[model samples]
Target: MVLRIFGLSFAVTVVSIIIAALYGGPQAVLLVVILSILEISLSFDNAVINATVLRRMSEFWQKIFLTVGIVIAVFGMRLVFPLVIVWLASGLGPVLALDLALNPPADDAAYFPDGSPSYETLLTDAHPQIAAFGGMFLLMLFLGFILEEREITWLSWLEKPLARAGKLDQLAVIVAGGLLLLTASYIAPEDTVSTVMVAGVLGMITYIAVNGLGELFNTPEEDENGEVVEGSSGGPTELAKATGKAGFFLFLYLEVLDASFSFDGVIGAFAITSDPIIIALGLGFVGAMFVRSITVFLVRKGTLSDYVYLEHGAHWAIGALAVILLVSIGYHVNENVTGLVGVALIGAAFISSILRNRKAAAAGGSSDNDVDEPKPVTIS
Candidate 1:
């Protein structure tokens, strides 16, 4: 199963390494490997969260995810997205932006000898807005999940209280908006305050719009007999796997989520090397393939069903990432710190899940197959 799932990723890793080596020799190969590991480590939680959504998608959409979705993730986010950001941030034309990315300044230089800002500088300059947009979107996701009531809780003490507080309408929006405002007013640079506010609000709105539309158009799954399949729990039925228009929106949500997750990684890649080709090879080819494979593995193996707290862990990690991104607008947060915090949260959750499983086994309860049933909370 492992080989079947990850075979393509391994093959791509070899191909990416070879490309990197041919493009810039052994040093490039090492950089690409490091960047790939970096992306995977940082995005492991992303894979978990993705599985939660991807499992609901039909096989056709799943293939779309592996094919078209990969192109978007690799080129659109890794290569083109950064270039677009540089273009807008620096007032450079698309052609010039592409040129700047390809012909970056030398190491230890922030600007070209001709006095123009390097592609890295332009991208770094754009970080505040990027952070604002991506941070708020992810913050909404985390807040929405954490605020929802669930049959199972990973951190009950905290989650229970939050769930109770969730009874208040639009609390997540309120909190996220307040944070964005606070960050804009005090945390972000004065000149970029307006930009941050606009970007952050847009992020929040995007999340609400996509998620709202998805639920609004959601229809229950039907069995082979055309009977409505009831949810796992008795009371309210679980949201059916989205299809048609709903599926397109959900897929759109996934892409935006991927872009948000990739923001920091794309920006942080400059800290490793300024070679766009190497970054594309590492992040787009090798790292992204593995992430997709991991998502597939989790979905096919029913890992989320088996490890009930994993979704919670991934959300918490996303919350941490959101905060880090917002904070990074004013301060420099190490990518290593971002990666470690996620790993720590997910690791702790995994351990707790195992313990819970063991306890349930001792009680002769069938917990191994239990899945999280987070009660649907209205996102106004």
Candidate 2:
């Protein structure tokens, strides 16, 4: 499997290097590799999350995820999301920024000899803003989770209705993504840190809101053969199909969510190193392998049921990332604190799950295998 993964990655690296060098020549190869590594580390959790979703998708969609999804990820999110985020942070978009940074005034043409913007000018224009964006994103993620959690308590009266409204996991993610975009555009300061913070926090929000609400609304059902379907509300036949679709969409949602989580790690890596070619190739190839393997593991090995609350741990990490990003936006976001708080919360949850498992064992309580896991799904 490792060799296979490497071989696949080599193919992808060659592709990325070719793409990166389209403008900058062979020198850009270094940049692609470096970026690739950064993305892989940041997106490990994303792979686990993707597996949960990939398991539910049709084989056709699964293929789409591996191929088309990679395009969306490497090109759309990695390449384009940064520019959009930076534009939002600075209030001067690519065109305007290029004009100002290169010309020192919007009035001049500011055209490069090659008819392109200078590398130094663009970097200087966006670095501080990206950092600030990253910082803000982390902080907001932390606060939003805490805040939304509180809303759960306050909405005791309308709990059922609101939950129903929030029932669509896809909608929840869309909302979170939209919110992040809005915040980055309107609220975050114009600096590099802020840009990164916004992306990270948005990723955190989408993960938390989608997963949290979906978990809350989860119910169980019974099949025609009288076998119980885990995590269902005992709904009728029609809803069972809906559940299947929801399960499938939930999987797609996870992939998008993972992509978002990967943004900060990708960008932060730039500060530690240079070489865009290395950056792209390394991050794209490694991240691809990680997510694909995870998808396979969950589908084949049934690991999701075995390790209950592992996903919860990831969501908590996203929440912490949000706060870290936010704090870093205006001030400094401490890695230790960000990591510690997330670890504590998720650790406590995991321990609680283990303890629950132990107690269940003592009482012969049902395992998630008997609960969350159902009969093997057929893609047909």
Ten-residue region with minimum lDDT total, candidate 2: 233-242
Q: After superposing candidate 1, which stretches have Cα over 4 Å from the reference?
A: 105-116, 222-239, 366-380
- Report clash pairs, candidate 1: none
Looking at candidate 1, the ten consecutive residues that score lowest on lDDT are 231-240
Q: After best superposition, candidate 1 residue 29: deviation in angstroms?
A: 0.4
Question: Residue 236's C-alpha lDDT in candidate 2?
Answer: 14
Number of the top-ranking candidate, with TM-score as the measure: 1
Report the lDDT tens digits of candidate 2 across residue range 222-275. Answer: 678988764343111112322344444454455455444655555565564433
Instruction: Give Cα-based local distance difference scores for all models.
Output: 0.84, 0.50
lDDT of 2 at 34: 54
RMSD of each: 4.7, 9.0
